[model samples]
Target: MSDNGTNTTDATAYDYSLYYSEDTSFFTPCNELDLKAFASVFLPALYSMVFVLGFLGNGLVVCVLVKHRNQTNLTDMCLFNLAVSDLLFALTMPFYAHYSAVSRWTFGEFMCRFISGCHHTGFFSSIFFMIVMTLDRYMVIMHTHKVARYRTLRAGLTLSAFVWLLSLCVSLPLMIFTEVSGDLYGLVCIYAPDNRAWKFYNVFVTNMLGLLLPLVVMVGCYSKIIPRLVNMKTAKKHRVVKLIVSIVVVFFIFWAPFNISIFLQFMQREGHLPNECKFYRDIKLAITVTETFAYTHCCLNPIIYAFVGQKFMKRALQMLSKWVPRIHFPPSRDLSEISFRRSSVTSKSSDITSTIMM
Candidate 1:
């Protein structure tokens, strides 16, 4: 009887060991997600919403800017290119939505590479344009006298092209590495770093080059602007400054979480972090949630532009005048009351223009 009892206890203990075994994903050659139905179901809806909003908002921006392409100023040029980047990025969301829903790259390998490259390309270009846009604002506010020669339409287009090229250079490596592979239960489309060293460098370089540098430039621009804003007596200047500040804050809010999580992931993978089961699970969850949050940043800019950019609001009203028969604003009203401040062609003259799109 005692022998039988001992055997039964041993069997129970073995079953417990099986139940509590470490998730071997931590030791695997590649990162794997033990995804549940929750991810498959929940993420599709969010991605869809982002796609819809992003498309509509960015489309409107393109339409408005292109219609007045001949008259577009430096800031208008920035807004237009920024919208282009967002629109391109948003186009790839449906593919990702399907990927999220199915947890597979059903579109095949070419698509796996193409779609991934496009999104990252758009990601880099958009942020680069944003950084340039902020720097343009800084130049206008602080060194208006010296900046006019370089803020021309030709200059802006050249800069935009340069940014796009830079984006392509940054994203090309991702295309080479992206592949579809089977992880125990299913197939995954992932960035297949060749080794641990490559993986670490990939995470380190992408985030550092793509995120950290731009963030510093944006922050520095806004920090300098803040003191000037406080000293300004005009309510209109305050409003413009406030809108710019809000834009900077929103950009940081959406992007910082995702990149910070990437840093944590690097640490954990490198054994700098404790390998607790719950911690790993939470980090994985955070990455999924935060990455989706980051995707929304592509579309969110137009909403902010619409609400806060008073001049842009005026132009929207003008556009609506055609569709809404009774709607009309006086021709004498400020067409662009609060433009990004700029100086005239002559360095000798400090004549500033108050033309921003409404």
Candidate 2:
């Protein structure tokens, strides 16, 4: 037996020659063909649709948040940052779509780095904001007395700045390593590590810091929140807790498999298991789909937080009533001052009530 590229290996392989042999036919079970077919038809469609939807959805979120900036709270600030990250991520999806469509990257070196950098930046920022949101929820639910001191608008802005800075730091390696290289027909943007160990290191860092740790935090926060909600006497507050819990559940369900798949792929690449196994191939395809859906989780958050959490639709309608064509109101400084004072008083009262309740 000699090494060739045809024969499919079982779940273990130390050397290439273990699977491929000179006596074996050049084409066995059409493994590459199956993989190509799946990648060609499925990946392009999945990436394209998710890209379009995510772009539009996140764009709407940004617009709505901007429009209602006066109503911004700590939660809204987190949502705004999340929407920005998603929008940037969605912008990069076209390049991925092009690659999937043509089975290659035609973009040059700078774009390759930029796109990869943006991808990592968006991913890190998204996860960071999510973790912050979970902590925000925890403070509001479990540590309400402390939220007023730490969860202010200024604090949220500072936290968001830190998130962006952290994301930028994490993503710098992508800019350094990713480049467009291959044949004329099939350029790929990949991290050209000095050694295989470096590749595994990159995968492990991304999987652990970017995905797994945040997931654990989210689950832990929501677990405590849910039990408290169940015991709450206030039905309205319970509903809000349930809604937040649902968001966390949805995030976990969408992202958990994608992150796990990255770990598995790293294992396969490191020769921990044979890549030629049918199970590996099938799981790879599942991973592609799962990742596509997981990335779109960003777009869903704005809807959950804005329209659903804050009743943006109804509030928008109320705000629009003042703009009817024939409606006119005489200028009244006294009334305006009274309204402003009333709002300030109401807000202070609500804060006091919340503090006392806690």
Best by lDDT: 1
Candidate 1 vs. true structure, TM-score: 0.82
Query: Using TM-score as the measure, which candidate wins?
Result: 1
TM-score of each prediction:
0.82, 0.77
Give the TM-score comparing model 2 with the true structure, all chains together: 0.77
Model 2 over residues 1-358: C-alpha lDDT tens digits?
1123222222111011111111112222324445555666776677677678878777777776788889787877888898899888778877876676666667777877788788778878988887887787677768766666877789989999999999998777545755544432244555654455555556765778767788789888878876765555442455566576677778778787877776776565556766465755565566666677777776676666655632454443344456554654333233234435445545443332222121
Q: What is residue 314's positional error in candidate 2, in angstroms? A: 2.9
106, model 2: CA deviation in Å?
Answer: 1.1
Q: For residues 178-233, what per-residue lDDT tens digits would candidate 1 score against the true structure?
A: 66554443445566655556555557555776678888997898788666545644
Predictions: Cα RMSD each: 9.7, 8.0
Runs in model 2 lying further than 4 Å from the true structure: 1-30, 183-185, 275-277, 315-358
- Model 1 residue runs over 4 Å out of place are 1-35, 321-332, 336-358
